[model samples]
Target: MSGLLCYCRGGFEPELAAELGERAAAAGHAGYAVTERGSGFVRFLTPAGDAAGLSRALPWRSLVFARQKLRLLADLDAVDTRDRIAPVLAALQAGAVDGTLAPRFGALLVEHPDSDEARPLAGLARALGNALRPALRKAGLLAAKDDPRRPRLHVCLLAGDHLLLALGDPADSAPWPMGVPRLRLHPDAPSRSALKLEEAFLTLLDDGERARLLRPGMTAADLGAAPGGWTWVLQRAGLQVSSVDNGPLRQHVLDGGGVEHLREDGFRWQPPRPLDWMVCDMVEQPRRVASRMATWFREGWCRQAVFNLKLPMKKRWLETSLCLDIFGREAGLPLELRARQLYHDREEITVLAIPTGR
Candidate 1:
């Protein structure tokens, strides 16, 4: 059976593999993932009889580590250096796709992994997509423009002469490569780190959730908020923030009047009332931070939370799984949880937990 291809950040292939494997098993179709460190991808192999239906059963919103998920249709070997395009087109045309998806391809995305060795191929991927799109359309395989109702074709370059072809539902796939939201640092924000929260909002939460949860004038607190990076993000969202830290926040953040800088320990500080949201970017053990964030939900201190978990150098996937499991048990709520290794994040992953009804 063919496998599901997952695009992820470099150096966290193990984490993505573990997550996909567990999610697939939990969904009643047990499977395993093949992964390599620093490769920026994982492939979860489907059961021999289950490949056709596996994608329909997997919940896109529940996945944390995978940026994009596609069912692999072809794995071409020994690609001709001078005539790769013809084989690629042939492979795609011959590939097994859903009977319903046979004629409707809304978009074509050519990409490579985000590893150090693979970085140079980005330009090549772009060039290939440019050349391939018209050919596909001419062959009646691709639609002229992006149609939300149709699926997307994914061509991933493996090496100079190897490649993988896959297909994804646009409704479930990442709009951008590796599921990373392209965000720019606001010039007026206290620090570039603000982009993390911005990206988190755009990626982790859907538009409906954001519209309802992040309304202007919502209250928030930023823990360990020195330099006011995350605080600046909250401010821009129109949340009056209590920036808690021992070190001083950026002067501009303090002067903004929407934020109240408190020289206090984030661990000990408590909001005067239940707030709308809480965001933490503190540098601490992944488990400890997860526990703290979970406690806030358990105690009903905040309605929602977005926090960072600083991972260790080894066994990161195991450690993160344990932490999230503990948080789920401790929170004891019907919670909607999502986590991702964002482009702006280094040595950490961001988590968003919202109490759906509890």
Candidate 2:
């Protein structure tokens, strides 16, 4: 029943624990150890009941089968450079180097006596990639040269003898790939903040889920609407948005009839009529934002909401718990709520909640 758990972000334990509960499809915790800040090796009760199935289900490349004994494999002095990494390349060729086996988007923990030894590790990864490219093509895990676009696969380089790779099956690929090489890595890319948070948000959204959250002709209020990122998202979904903030929004966002700009204090302002949606990204204490969200829900001022709660300097898990509890107690409505440290966010968690009825 003991296995490893890998999380996003570096050095935040409470956030990782909160993520585990939020991702409730998994099993209970037995014990866990932080391998690195954002990532960890854990021994937990396997939800799958079978060891092999659990191993297959979890993102193992980012996570390793540490079993119940949380031991660190730090015998760097004895490591065989070439031999240690061969099996990992073989797994990548076989298309077995999945996110669970190797995290395609997390950090690797490595220690070298000097920078000289670390150079080989970097060289080895490049050499392995050279070997993997042709093999992946032969396996049909990669697209043929004639294909209009070469599918950009997700990859992670770990410190140990492992290569984490996520093959982008053509049918399931994103409309536009993010995070991988050759794709223009935008400075404002949403999924770049924390891998786990991005994963959680994507996991929560499907075509149906997104459609359910958005409705045509719905009136929306967006707090902290400067530069109009969230408002941009809502307007694209065909909702009419009143973007509220003292700061100016992007001229294009305001030019459209779908969006209106209002220079006002979001906390103090109230809509003349109940809004269909309320979204906020204000930089404030999480509890205050949670209380305000609860008020909107309880007062029937908004039927559904999405907002970001900025976590404190420490104890992020405690803050998330407190916010959730506050909402549950104060909202006084049947609610379906979800929170994740989104890929688009930094030092804050995004929450979505909907009342039971339309």
Candidate 3:
């Protein structure tokens, strides 16, 4: 069926499904979501058979739950084991002729869904991708070499013989496969949680903004910075940091003298003056943390902020929407806010907020 196929974190299919349904309707597309619990994916089927139009209506970065989004081309089931590549090639050729898909693609990504049930297919995906490259190039469907500027073709394996063919536009979709960035923790980092902030900078901000805003010598504050994981990231980025928490930090983090640890409660502490950035990862209720974050912006304490909201609630999407609404309205300013459930995050979402004029 013609629809938008979205990949999300395992066990979050319901949230993603609900988001797709509401978003598609809001974008003036009539569609119903089809998903299985813990399946790690959702399909929003449109009877109008306008998957392309719907995909265009919903931009990838606008989505909170989805890791990757693709326009459905065909769903091939029960394929013969002897020749798995033939059907995919056929689908590509047909779609190209019908104007449903691009005649040429920049890249081909063969990926499995992100779920325990689908993990075993990783090897098969890798093998099939290697096997398909030559045939696709010979058929003139795939480029001889990878091109980052063109659209990508996706072959997502629902099962060994059950394949979902889709197309991804580079301009609108995640650059990484499965929408998960592969980042390694720095050995000098005080804790593994530092990766969360690193990923936030990469995922939340564009290249130009990163270059313009996060220059060396910028000042920042890290609330709840015990053990100094987030504080270390700010320091590594060449920012002098004020680490606020009522606990001790690693001695090495202090050795550089870039970080100043304060023995104070995160919620109670305030920057003495305006700063370039403020980050918090305190374990608190989503609304309380959001309201506190709004205080920072409303009071003109910081120009930009990146924080996390702990979401152990049953209705996560509702909570996410409510908390974001509260943050925006309470801040009482024209702020650009972006949030995502990063791969490193568990039971939480990371948010970045900056004033529009900044």
Winner by lDDT: 3
Candidate 1 error regions (>4 Å): 47-49, 98-101
In terms of lDDT, model 1 sits at 0.82
* Poorest lDDT segment (10 consecutive residues) of candidate 1: 95-104
Between candidates 1 and 3, name the one with more favorable lDDT.
3
**1-358: candidate 1 lDDT, tens digit per residue:** 5768888888888888877777777778867888788998888887664665677667566676777878777777799878778887786666456423355588888888878878899988988889889988988889988876787888888887888888877777787865566777778888888889998999888889889999988999899999899998888788999999999888888787799998999977888899999999998888888888888888888999999988898877788788888888888788978887777888788999887652
TM-score of 2: 0.63
Instruction: Estimate the TM-score for candidate 3.
Output: 0.97
User: What local distance difference test score does each model get?
Assistant: 0.82, 0.54, 0.90
Q: RMSD per prediction, one decimal?
A: 1.9, 8.2, 1.3
- Per-residue lDDT of model 2, residues 1-358, tens digit only: 2333332434454456444434334543233333434342222334333433343443322121111111121112233456644443455444342223322311222211112323346555566556655655655455444242432443334454443333332333222222211222334422232232233334435567666767788899988777777776677668999888998877767776698888999887778889988988788888999998899988888988877788888877777788988987999999877665544456777777876543
- Candidate 2 has its poorest 10 consecutive residues by lDDT at 64-73
lDDT measured at residue 340 in model 3 versus the true structure, 0 to 100: 87
- Each model's TM-score, in the order given? 0.94, 0.63, 0.97
Ranking by TM-score: 3, 1, 2
In terms of TM-score, which candidate is strongest?
Answer: 3
Q: Candidate 3: lDDT over CA atoms?
A: 0.90
